[model samples]
Target: MHPVLFKIGSFELASYGLMTALGYAMAAFYLLPRLKKINLDRDTFWNLIFIAFMGALIGAKLLFIIVSWPQLGATTAEKIANIFRDFRYGFVFFGGMIVSVFSLIFYMKKKGLAVFKTSDFLITALPLGHALGRIGCFLAGCCYGRPTDMPWGVTFTDPHALVAPELLGVPLHPTQLYEAGGNLVLFFILHKLYNKPHKNGMILLAYISCYAFMRFIIEFFRGDYRGAFIFGLSPSQTISLLTALAAGALWIYLQKKETKNG
Candidate 1:
């Protein structure tokens, strides 16, 4: 359970951060081949992807910070200081998704990439990249699940685990694995759909709808406090519902647009 994967002199490399970087590197490798297959301009795609990558990283951190803020807060200085103390932890996946997608859509507009079409292109990358990110989460032991007695459950004795020693020796759902499995399934579906003659944004619409639904289910097992319960569901659940609705609406609208064109 080495949370610190290794050290280079004074610099300690965290398994969490290193794995996340590897995930994106894998994403670039996978995405380039797909883009070339579709005849997208590699140079422009690379440059834009880099911007999207930066946006995703910053957005992920910002989202994590926001979710973890209540614990660190009262004043701006308090919040800023908290970041210095625990920056390597506390990132919320949904928050990063929101910011990263917004940045991508905005960048697409700037580059004259059709919003829907570009979104379709991104669908494949999103899930693949995200699955890798969740792998990093598992290594870091941050977004872990509650204690359980299931046969296949995992035990994180590492001090890195958000779970305490009292909670150790007990089995717990590997919520990170749950998310990674879901995202990988989503990657397969989106990649399969990418080649079909669906409408421009159908794949994205499908991915959003599917991933939102999946995340809502997975969040139940997470031990971290995610804000309040609106009608018994946590804040993340409520947001997932909204995203699901939006995805469904987008899918319907795309279907209608395709119909009209036909």
Candidate 2:
């Protein structure tokens, strides 16, 4: 896994950035077809996606920087400079997901589009595209797991894995692959659920619940000292807990409504 996909005489295209762009393109393309099923306007859908894309990037970076503030042995100015110097590093997926969803909802509302159903449309793409992006994470070695002695453990031998071999070469849990597989399964579940009659946004709720559960579990396997994990609960895990609870409550409410109406 090469972090820098390639270089052109001082300009390097990072695999992380490349994967992010590819993931968004895939997600947007997938949503285009599903948006029709949800009866959302094509133009509105595109606009909303654009807004969500920017929101996700900014939110993810902001949250990552905030959470990593303790580890920054650098000043605020240096950290700011680093972001400009290397845009490929540091992004928090859950932060981006939450921000993107809310921002897109706001955008769609301003456009007079159906926010709930469009949110559901995004669910179908979220896991699939997230899985693709994790493949990038595996290549880029940003969200790595803890050291391990498992036979199937992986070594960050690839330069794209970012961190040095001294810090990363030990046999480690392939958390990225684990997550990519988890997301793939979630994608299929959402895809099938979409075919059934459930309230709009229920699929998205389901995604949040499922993904949060997995992320919470996976945090235990990560060796790096994310503040969330440092205190025995990673920020992602705490957020996951909240997201799961909210999604569960919403799902139950929707189910009761359908039952009463039926």
Give the per-residue lDDT of model 1 (tens digit) for 1-262: 4567878998988877887788788777888877755567888788767877777668777766766678677998988887887567667767777787888788888878788877788667778878888888877776778877788788877765666557665677889999999999999998889888877788888888898899899988987666665787876788799999998788778778879999
Q: What are the per-residue Cα lDDT tens digits for candidate 2 across 1-262? A: 5777789999988887888788888878877766657677777777777887888888898888888887754688877777676767888887787788788877778867666677787778888888889888888887888888888788877744765557656888888889989999999999899989977778788888899999999988876656855456889998988898898888888788789999
Maximum-lDDT candidate: 2
Candidate 2: lDDT over CA atoms? 0.80
- Total backbone clashes of candidate 1, pairs 3 or more residues apart or in separate chains: 0
Query: Model 2, residue 93: what's the lDDT?
Result: 88
In candidate 2, what residue range of length 10 has the lowest lDDT sum?
159-168
Please report how far candidate 1 places residue 190 from its true position, in Å.
1.4
Alpha carbon lDDT at 207, candidate 1:
88
Candidate 2 lDDT score at position 151? 89
